[model samples]
Target: MSLARRHREYIQSLTAASAPAMDGGLAPAAAFDAAAGHAPSPAGTISTAAHTINLRLQHDLRRLKEIRSVANKIAVKQELIGEYDAWVAGLLEAGRTAPRGTLAPTGADEVLPTIMVWAIDTGDWRYALALAGHVLRHDVALPARYQRDAATLIVEEVAEAALRAQAANNAFPLDVLEQVEALVDGVDMHDEVRAKLLKAIGTELARGVDAADAGDARRLASAAIDRLTAAQTLHDRVGVKTQIKGLEKALAALPAPEPTDPNTTAAPPQT
Candidate 1:
């Protein structure tokens, strides 16, 4: 199904569900409407109706979680990255819409693992970066290990793509570079993949050193310095310096700052 269609159906199922009439006996029409919160009435048991809705929501979310592997493959084959994004987004919406009291941390909660697996297995960095950012931004707390592992996979996959492109002496695609840079900005790092990530980031930055757009030099230098600093922390600076030096030279060539008017002195330190 198209992601949008599937999503509409999912939403329909969620919003349209009503608690089974107590013990299979039908609830009074007015009571039922009131219980479902479709109307205000004094006779309905709102608490019972709410619990029923939460249970149904929990069930559907679990089902979605179960089907995630299938969804993952479908997403990749059809280039349905947006669907994957929507599915995760839907999970969040479900939490608020139906309101589960205590979600087990396993179902939609752990979908990032599968998404990260797809990214690494298919060597799809774009999808991987989206998953990384989604998890980092998510209001639901994923397990610490999943967070760590997702970061590792995101870096490794980006570096893998960057290195492959580098082998041909071609720049990494700008989109890929930007996504990886965003991941680096948000995800926590592990030393195991630190140098690899730095290499990719630094190489992309270094490309600006000789760019026709001379304006890119300082930007590249600033970017590289940031990564180089992180690499130093990881104790994984194997290939960082060369890129840093190259970027430093590019910054050196930037036109000297416009003469600051002695009249335009730096703003006094903010109070």
Candidate 2:
């Protein structure tokens, strides 16, 4: 069978398997809590669904651990993207069962953040950013091994991906980079990482300066300079000095705007 067809079937199977856990067909979280000598969660908090999801998370994480190399992990991520989508969808559906404010953190959840990374790895920017909104809202802790907060991870990973794509002359979506910037605005992260993001945005903007008409070239180049300058100020080693010079030169070479004819009479207003 073709890979796409197989992938669809896999997603369907995963959704079918996860429906029971989402619907509370699995063992109650209270039973596991009591057995482990942990205090029970408050009533209607959906601990049963949380516990079921956690069990699935543990299973997936174990499988990930067995992959020995980066390439292998990437391949596995492609295979599992469908599964992650189902899990995320199930969580969103299950969350509706409880009041928004009443929903408590179930401690560190590796699933959502892991899925975020995997989504990025597989070039699923839309999916990754959607999850970023939820993860940041809840202040979900990333896995211990990540050693970075969600905002930092999101910025750095997406920035690095954009840079790589640019290097290869591939068209990385500027909107995706802009969305990442807006999503993580005001969140604390290393200056270096932030600079990387700015550089990516600046470079992407600079790409179109050459092909643009005089007006557009000036505007794009100016914006590119602003971003690149901010990046340089944040981290001198961000390595955008050459790009800045090139854009500035281009902007300077653009034809000057025609002088406004202030003496010309204004056209009559249309009905």
Candidate 3:
């Protein structure tokens, strides 16, 4: 299959992989609490309410541990991609069960963004994308800006992986590229981070221009133009601006595209 098509499939698989298990085993928190007939403790004096909160948190952690152990077992036997995907689905559902204002950072927050990347390295990009999405959702609930930052860092690593794969004639990291775009949607990355990512993409795209045929140069020019154009939008970092100028000049000098079909050569009109 074409790399592009596979990438598109990988992205679509995220939604399917995120689908909840059909066995009807555990209901969402709201439904589960209702069915179990467990009422959350009423708000009261600070100390008592705090105690209640801690107890509930402990229960929640225990449930997460149950799934984590099962997921690890699956990872040992099957693919971590499948294990992480199902685990994410369960975590999201469990989030729904917590009483309003009671949802806080769980230990899953640390692992969700981490394990998925391992899956990516092991050749499960789709599952990694799904896992990152789940982790980002959890980060949205936290007051720590750094969790979001960490997610972006993971995405940048994925972006680098994608570029490397492209160079090696392997899978495209478009899923991870999209993830990077999604991660930075409203967030401002540090200047260093922004410049580092842009430089990596630009340098990689520009690597072969000196030796490339017209077609290859044109392809490289197009990607560099797009990447540096986006870098401008990201920030006015000096390094990025330098890259943009150089790439634009090189693009302007690239020859027009070469025709692909041998039988369809350029021809003069007959009189």
TM-score per candidate: 0.51, 0.76, 0.45
- Summarize candidate 1's per-residue lDDT along 33-128 as a digit string, tens digits: 333445532333332333344454455345546665864654543453333555454444544445433222222344444555556556566656
| C-alpha lDDT values of all predictions | 0.54, 0.73, 0.50
Tens-place lDDT per residue, model 2, 127-240, is: 888877666765767888888988999999999999999999887899999999998899988999999999999999999988999988889999999999999999999999
lDDT of 3 by residue, 16-61 (tens): 3322421232112222222224453222211222233345435633
RMSD of each: 10.6, 8.5, 12.2
- Mark the 10 consecutive residues where model 3 has the least summed lDDT: 41-50
Tell me, by TM-score, which candidate is best.
Answer: 2
- Comparison by lDDT, 2 against 3, better one: 2
Between which residue pairs do clashes occur in model 2? Answer: none
In candidate 3, stretches whose alpha carbon ends up further than 4 angstroms from where it belongs are 1-85, 92-111, 120-123, 140-148, 162-175, 200-223, 229-249, 255-271
Number of clashing pairs per prediction, in order? 0, 0, 2
